[model samples]
Target: MKFSRQILSSSFSLDKVPGWTCPWCDKSAVSGKKDDFRIIESVQSKSQHSHPEWEPFRITGTFCGTLICSDENCGEQVVVSGLMEVEERGWCDEGEYFSSYEEILTPLFFVPAIKLFNIGNNIPIAIKDAILETFSAFWQDLSTAGNKIRKVCELIMNDKKIVKTYIDKNGKRKEYSLHTRIDFFGKLKKGEREQKAYGLLMAIKWIGNSSSHVNNSLTKADIINGLEMLHHILELLYDKDYMRIYKLGREYNKKKGPLKHPLFGTRHL
Candidate 1:
């Protein structure tokens, strides 16, 4: 499932709140209660307030709030905290324009975590754990999150039984890198699905490599891109329904009509 990019990247506003996906029940969206938001001015901002030329736009603080899932049955709760800043907003009233400063919260952390995408039950436990770790680290540390994503790649290799270490011609066993393992998986498997998965895995591996750098410049958007690719890979690998539909589609295209069953006769297109 593709996540809402706008919701994940945008700042939180009391007037127009962003809907966060419920971690417990991925189907439901969670919204914040205005009363639940607690904003505290930073010491630096408080000191600057005494200045003669202090402006609202210069104000900054930290905010914490509670978001409750909209689904009554789920009613899952999430705690969010972030940096709050005031920015100028303009509105026109009868052709007259007026500007005002508004508070916008940029989320830094979420407790219980928000779902980025659905995880299939068929995925290995190790991969699932790594994916969950990546989600938790996303808001707090992008670099760490990227590393976790790399860990998921390793776990994927393990799940597929791709050898981590192999004997070289020199009689020494060398550990294969994630890049090598992914390439090996592609070589071992033959199909359109494996080809697609190989391309996606390569992209994710590149992101992970960049994230491993000491002074990496990985952004939240970059991490989201990686997660999206991972989601597709998981579907390709573990979602039996997806495979079934793909095979059926190929058969239909080849015959240019509905497939025929031996017992049921020709099926409807």
Candidate 2:
């Protein structure tokens, strides 16, 4: 596969958006890496289909590209795949620009939740696993995506220890397993920390139940609601603490060592 960097940015009517930036011009200096995309290959397909109304023909191609920093000045290359689609406008109709445009994010491919948590690194294994399925759900099956989102919730519950044990009226000890998803929601409704996640988790749980147990076909709205809710929920559970912990680490690292060493082990490095 041929590799190249493509900047992933939200498109607008404005043409020039991160495809390239002026390195030499200080006034327009873009202070980050570029070319984070690698071209898997260029693909094109042309076909004709009968349209009862106005659909005479359609042509579309998707490019799978590996993502890495193309900025030679800054050397950090991590691989992620994003698909961009190009289509032919000459067949049926045309837009203003070159008769075509590149789609940054589409149902055909999944867009990774960005670096708000850790700059595309330090994402948990569970989240990473769910992410692939989430994309698959986006394009292939809404029902399947809802299931994957529930997995993300389960993982979050495990990581956070959402279950609780308590004392009963008879002076007996009791514990809540939260073993099942229903049990998990029960806990969420009761605790302050868990309450923060209550509404979002409820929606996710409902989606899962609707898709899996009820055997109901999910709507695009259902899938989208679950996806967006999980995004924010994960951020609340995992990401909000990032700055707090980083600052604490910085403070702790600033401390100096003791006057004498017993085992000759350094207290701080």
Separately for all candidates shown, the number of backbone clashes (residues 3 or more apart, or on different chains) is: 0, 3
Question: Model 2 over residues 130-199: C-alpha lDDT tens digits?
Answer: 7656655555566777788777777666666665567889989886433454466656556443566767
User: Taking the tens digit of each residue's C-alpha lDDT, what string does model 1 give over 1-269?
Assistant: 46566776788678887887788888888888789799888999989987999989999999999999999999999999989999999999999999998899998888888777778889888889889889888878888988889889889889989989989999999999899999999999888888899899999998999998998888889988898888889988888778877877777888898657532225522
Candidate 1 Cα RMSD (Å):
3.0
Per-model TM-score, in order, reads 0.89, 0.46
- Measured on C-alpha atoms, candidate 1 has an lDDT of 0.86
User: Which pairs of residues collide in candidate 2?
Assistant: 4-37, 4-39, 38-66
Name the candidate that leads on lDDT.
1
- Estimate the overall C-alpha local distance difference test score of candidate 2: 0.49
